[model samples]
Target chain A: MSDMSRPGVIHDLGYRHYDGLREGTPAIARTLFVTGLRHVYGLGRSGKSKVMPFLLLAMSVLPALIVVGVVVLTGLDSLPVSYADYTNQTQLLVSLFAAAQAPVLFSRDLRHRSIVLYLARPLSAPVFAVMRWLSLTVALWLFMAVPTLMLFIGAMLSGLDKSDQVTQLLKAVVLQTLLALLIAGITGLISSVSLRRGFAVVGSVMALIVLTGVVTAVQAIAAEQDADSASTTAGLFSPWSLYSGLANAWDAGIDTFVPVDGAWAVAYALVALLLAAACLLALVARFRKVGSR
Target chain B: MAVVTGERTGQAPVITTAGLTKHYGSVHALTDLTVDVGEGVTGLVGANGAGKSTLIKILLGLLEPTGGHARVLGHDIEHESQEIRRLVGYMPEHDCLPPDVSASDFVVHMARMSGLGASAARERSADVLRHVGLDEERYRPMGGYSTGMKQRAKLAQALAHDPRLVFLDEPTNGLDPAARNDMLRLVERIGSDFGIAVLVTSHLLGELEQVSDHVIVLDGGHLLRSSATGDFLQRTGSLLVEVVGTETERDRLGEALAQRGLVCRPRGAMVAIDPPPSELAQEGAAHDLIRDVAAELGLGLMRLQPDRGHLEDVFLDGAPRV
Candidate 1:
């Protein structure tokens, strides 16, 4: 072959050999988790993706801002809203955030058929599923916690009694974190199975929000008929009811959407944990099939 | 880069499979297949449903085989699949890119997943993207890229980790002829210049004939033939002769050559002359006879070339049984 007619030039683009340690499974999982987190918040995505998550987060915090404003202007010795009640009040925004963002973490990959790329890496199917769930859980926690944190800060700056309020607020934030995990788990599971983003969003909202209303209504009807056991058992069908039941049972002062008494509160806590675990198991099982369309 | 020479030493095969099989319920995607692939560019030629993707996924440890076993780069496909994946790069057969992520970011993330450090991953991503002939467009989101550009971006990510081997499944799919040629040349360079073993697949049999050192033909999930590219393209015992004139000259040569005791037939504007039997043949005897006959008949001999076999011949010849 003659080379004179075809002029060629080589430019070094600094393609270097990687002699550093090739981290193992944990590192791969961590990278996916971080990537999933960024994806949920639309950090690397287009401008349209940034809309839903930011809007939901702002909606979640807006009421807390108003409460703080009212307290600061009126100089109330005690905060008007209780810490635990704050999450319950903004539960709708938190649920909406989960419905919108869970699909971003789970459904987009399957819809684009990009899950194959992730599975071909060193990470296993279970690890990938767990990491995505964890990322969404953390994001949901931040969405709920930010508003609660704002209220806590407002109370502290307004010279309210720091000791009791801080203790109660910390408990409430922990409860909110648990609730976020429960919501993320359920929505993540739904998103994984529903390959279409629109379907996943609708399904998640229905599972997390609409079902709560239906279950609460059923519980109220059951209580009106004096069927106490059926009323308490009906609350188990809705995660919001279960969370409220547990929080209210722990402290009688905390107002809950659904009143849970006696050992049913313990059952509610156990069922919530079990539901999260079940969702995780379903996600792992879905990914383990090896070929996901 | 040092090639990781596993248990095998001299002339070791890069991939070896024995009785590998896969089935999806009643549909048997791959039957019992056994083959050994050596270093360099090996083309896997098959129809769309010939289980090419199934075999690649099995080798990468992404899909479990229904029966038999295989190994890539001396690692067991079943047990050491993670090891196989860590060392082998894969460009899937389908569109698997995230539309929202830029090529640079996606490739870097893939490199990191392959265990490259942050700086190394970024540098490797840039280098591979450039090597694949991607320029400033690499920074743009992949959704807007043309099919050729998307294929190149996929190739760039597959090479970002600089593995010892790579499985490129239909890298030239959906590309125009010019772009296909460019992609084939890049594939050839990856094997030759980078010293990385490549197992590339394609449905177009003619496309791999140029770039592949070895070719494997699969039919209905069964191994039809596996051999060196030269073996598949060995010269048949025939010669094609083209004359200066059109059909008239070609028929004249065919008749004249037939009279000389050579089996001759007109193929388009050319006459295909079967080689003379060994008992009546000598070196250049056929050539001399053709020239003499053409000269006597006042016909100009334009071309006298041996009829070469093609990769498609394997499928065409085996089509009856299949």
Candidate 2:
């Protein structure tokens, strides 16, 4: 009976066939989607351990918002006010939004070596790259979108309206969301290439805030030195500077100090898009190399 | 490609790899490894960083080799890894249990991922888990499990998919001795009872002597030796002799044997001697020499026997002394 019991158990598992490759496109796509969803829910349902930088972001912006609010609330009529001025302050919020969301979205998988588990099943590197980038871009857009909308509401209600008020407000929110996604995607791609999460985050923040700022300052000086030439907006190739150009466009004119328009803005978006794609492809290539090793 | 439904028809090995090499930058994890593992239980013995894990990973298609190729169950591992993964069961070297998932749920999910239907997956998972000795505790989160239970859970997951080839990578790594024995026995049954091809790896070489049909020794990511278990334990032609009467009698017998020009060494109460090959030609003379030597010194012969090499000796010789 003991012998009988033994074979009975082995027989029950039946048989498995794994000699042939599974090449069905539908099956591959389904597996990729399911795995991507698993990653999304895995991070989201990781409970309260999900690092919420919203609080830290609010604290950082609170001081600047208070300064703006004090002047507005006290009816300080002599204080400077315009849509362009509001856009500049909101630019700080955009930078803060980029700083908060990019690291958590990109670096968490690499930090945990969870990429090994994810890639081992069925998904390859390119599918993984596209899925993860889309997940992060969508999550970042949501995180940055709702708050920016609320701020837009607050701005509109703050007794500021012109003939192009509605169009400008809608355009501002749409451009801000697109710009946030572009920045998040670029940073996410960059961060995935780095080994440590903290270093990646620090590097991305510096790239967005410092390097891009320096480039835009250099361009501004160049445009001033050669006033005859079209405004030197070449620095807009950086996503942060590209968004700055978007704000300039929203103002219906350049800051004069930093002229931008015509083919220059298109060239900026083209370069940023190309860099974002190239970084994404590099991320895919990196994963293949790491996993193959 | 058509699925070959029954057992393998040819005498070809289930796994064969040639010139398998893996390098982690400058560190050669596996170097110039060539092995052909037949059906049944084969034990891979090595110390840490001895390339046991690297070979297993290469076989499982989780790693791509730098120099060579491995075929599992007649499938090319480099080009057809997904298929290899489907046919082979792999228990990883590390503790990688998802904390929130129960053992049963995780194993069932794995079975399904290997292409089982819902009912088959559930039924197989339960049966495999039960066979592994996990009880109601299996329903609990694996995060709180003891090392033995966790090891069993990992083993169960590997078997749940009904794989033809299973790579048990240090399955008994953290288990207590009893648990280790149980896991080893389970591994033995997987080969003998189920007709599965099992390649189990361990740093502890001697423990696999009884269960393994073949033993493969790996050192510094290279194959040192591979042989049948019996071949590993064959006699080495030396014999141990022990005579009991009095301590003086035993020593005098030893002295007399040495005076006779026999090469003998005092080993505890027993004096071991290497029999002259000419004396070995006649069994009676060899026996008489031992008895005569003891009697000449008025010692009573208690025991005299040929020394058979043990699996430990094989490992000792093959293992890197450093």
Candidate 3:
């Protein structure tokens, strides 16, 4: 006897062909920047990954909140805390944030050897490096700017004089942006070279914190010994001192952590620009050779 | 089937390298190697450190060659790498997936990087993941996946963009025998059914013989051999004849074939006959003689075929010891 014939079926899972517009390098860089920004704050990662960044962010905003509270309660016309000096006061927290988070943006890809996947796309190494640097720079800017924005909002709510306060706050925000770029460039460079997370975190923290401490000590001893040039040069070694020197040079009214004045101001500005450019160049070079081996 | 052979009548070469050399300081990773890869599944067979990965990287434009020039899909490797990368996909040999990301998210991100729009990336990622047989498990973190699942995830990402060409670097690296066979079948389907050119690498010589339309062997950073898979296993001028029943039946056939002035020997349940002398080179002479001998002996001829070469023979003969 013949067997019974069965009906056949075909499934349509909507696997459509994509004939849409394909973006080029700029769109790719933008996508990478957005993804990296989310990664920096642990947005797509596990819950455990969110703790450190949130904690550090809260810590950064605490002092600003307290200042704003005092201004609101006492009904002061002017903020007790100068906006420009807030970054200096909270430099440790900003440095810590950069140290802890730069690896999340830069090192993890290399450690997991995922850089190959990235480079295999229609992206170049230099573009990848620049996008990563820009993402961290923007993240750091937001990290510092949010608290400063809070202070501005508090002053406005308390009915402080509009023109002068806004002017000063705007200048402080500019200075903070510069400081953010400086920190991101240096920390991102260090993290790019150290693929191990623990090692990269330690290296970034030490480079930003320990080196600044040593430079500060040397500046202090040099100033006491009446060594003017030595103290000025000492201030050039650490990102914190460099930002402080630039602020002083720009006449921001914030107290300089180290004595940077006269011709030293131009020197400090030149050195900071050169240092940022150098770190960026190094990062590009590192990524260029990333998967070649 | 109209297979797309890169060097065949109408198809052009998919990849071409001329005098390609790479040096890592004192270590020469790839010597002056020149080769052409046609369409279809082309297997790249070599031992470990035989420059298989190096060649793939160079072809993908991920690594710069110290010497020589190359092109992929008509794009120059040196000047037009962006164009090359835009058209090709790569599945690296190492463990490259992030531990925290799900396979779906990662594949979608890869598709986006390949210039797909947001909606297209998501849709393509789903399609490729399903094609690679990663079901609901694709939504879980890749760090928790087994080795075979990870390989499938890598393959899905490589296909996420619907590339015209793909360089799969050891897709079956850690797979068991069954998984390995499945991966090979998928590779063959990619080349034949999907019409995408594939350059897959493996150290296991025999495994690729079944799937690859063409095989290229490399040894010590040099091109050892390149040819069609059938050419690599072409007939070796001998015939294998099997008869039904036990050794007695096979022996009777062998003895009768010998008595017919044809040299033959028992091989398991079959008899092997070497090529006859030049005087017996006339068409159908050897065939008719064997048929007549078997008929005279009343033997049941079960099978008759030419002895074919194997990939292992090529590897054993040409591959240098590591």
lDDT of 2 by residue, B160-217 (tens): 7678888888888888889889988898988988778899998887777878888887
Best by TM-score: 1
Model 1 iRMS (Å) reads 2.0
TM-score of each: 0.92, 0.68, 0.91
TM-score, cand. 3 = 0.91
TM-score of chain B of each: 0.95, 0.89, 0.89
Ranking by DockQ: 3, 1, 2
Candidate 2 chain A lDDT trough over 10 residues, lowest sum? A14-23
The ten-residue window of minimal lDDT in model 2 chain B covers B1-10
Instruction: Name model 3 segments beyond 4 Å from true.
Output: A1-16, A225-228, B1-7, B25-28, B243-269, B291-301, B316-322
lDDT of each: 0.85, 0.67, 0.86
Clashing pairs in 3: B6-B38, B6-B39
10 residues in a row with least lDDT, candidate 3 chain A: A1-10
Worst 10 residues of 3 chain B by lDDT: B1-10
